[model samples]
Target: MINLQWQSFSKEECAKKLRTDIAKGLSQQQAASRLRTAGPNELAKPKKKKLLVRFFAQFCDFLVIMLLTAAGISFAVSFYRHSSDYIDSIIILAIVIINAIIGVVQESRAENAIEALQKLSSPCARVVRGGKEYAVPAEKLVPGDIVILKTGNLVPADIRLTESSSLQVEESALTGESIPSSKKAETVFPPATPFSDCRNMLFS
Candidate 1:
């Protein structure tokens, strides 16, 4: 993992450590190598349950388990007595199966909706490589790569600003602040400083 303590270093120091030019950014070959080493810059999606597993999980609830146990016992008693009361047991089993199916359908729909929203929210980024700028999917970014940002562009990853000219960012997505925070490129803050106060760093 990349230590964010790099934020405490000067732009020149960071460039020296990352072995990239702040002015020209990383060459295409260097960016490709770093991508293999650092992996992509993307948010981790929540793990989802398989459809059959999710459907079965509904029976794991305490109330549902008890209902099943009751149904089983009722079924046994009706079988022993040879009474029409066995129809009641059948009805109970049917109700439980129907309820489980409904739960599964609802949860599957919800998961699909969440997945759609995640796809819609995927961010794109602008980066400089080999002295040329390219617009690429944000998930392809890697550490040591130089990114260019403008107003309304989402910060694709944790970044230590190398240059700033009248840069201001709305960090309410992470900090819950309602105002746009002013940014600076030259200042190095203490490592223990809170995120809301790190004017020299930008976060994804």
Candidate 2:
């Protein structure tokens, strides 16, 4: 596993620490082993989800149950009245079925969106991993991972940049900026300015 100890330092400081550890009569492997044994360099495990309960929960919406009960009541009323309203019964039953189908479709769509794994399918990435460079899936990324950016590519994740040579991003979704915002790596105060003036982020 790649170890990322990003706290208590800037990017340059982190790089210098890696080099200094190697220069102190310790092999790269030994330095890496020591970092791992520290147990503070790894990303925390994410929470797990219950698949079976979630799958069953999808069909238990109040809309479908209410429609079904209404249809049953309609049939019972017609029967108790000794009336021959076959057409009316069919209409009520059809409404119940249609409502059930609509609920199923809506529930499934919502579930798929919540459970789907989001990723950047960019065929190329300037990625730094295991203290070296490689091309990998954007989904595999965690915090403190460094990625190089350029035009014509969506940003892979949120980052507190320590370097940028003219970074920019389209942030209409997050800030409703109505335009692509220019970015810099400099730190800013807590919500001190409007989106028009704040230029320190790159977001999808």
Backbone collisions counted per model: 0, 0
Tens-place lDDT per residue, model 2, 30-88, is: 43465466443224655643555544454476775666677678788889999777666
Best by lDDT: 1
TM-score of 1: 0.85
lDDT of 1 by residue, 79-179 (tens): 88886677767777787888889999999899889879977888888998878899878888877778999888988988999999999998898789898
lDDT of each: 0.84, 0.55
Q: What's the distance in Å from true for residue 158, model 2?
A: 0.9
RMSD of each: 2.5, 7.6
Compute the lDDT of residue 199 as modeled in candidate 2.
58
* Candidate 1 minimal-lDDT segment of 10 residues: 1-10
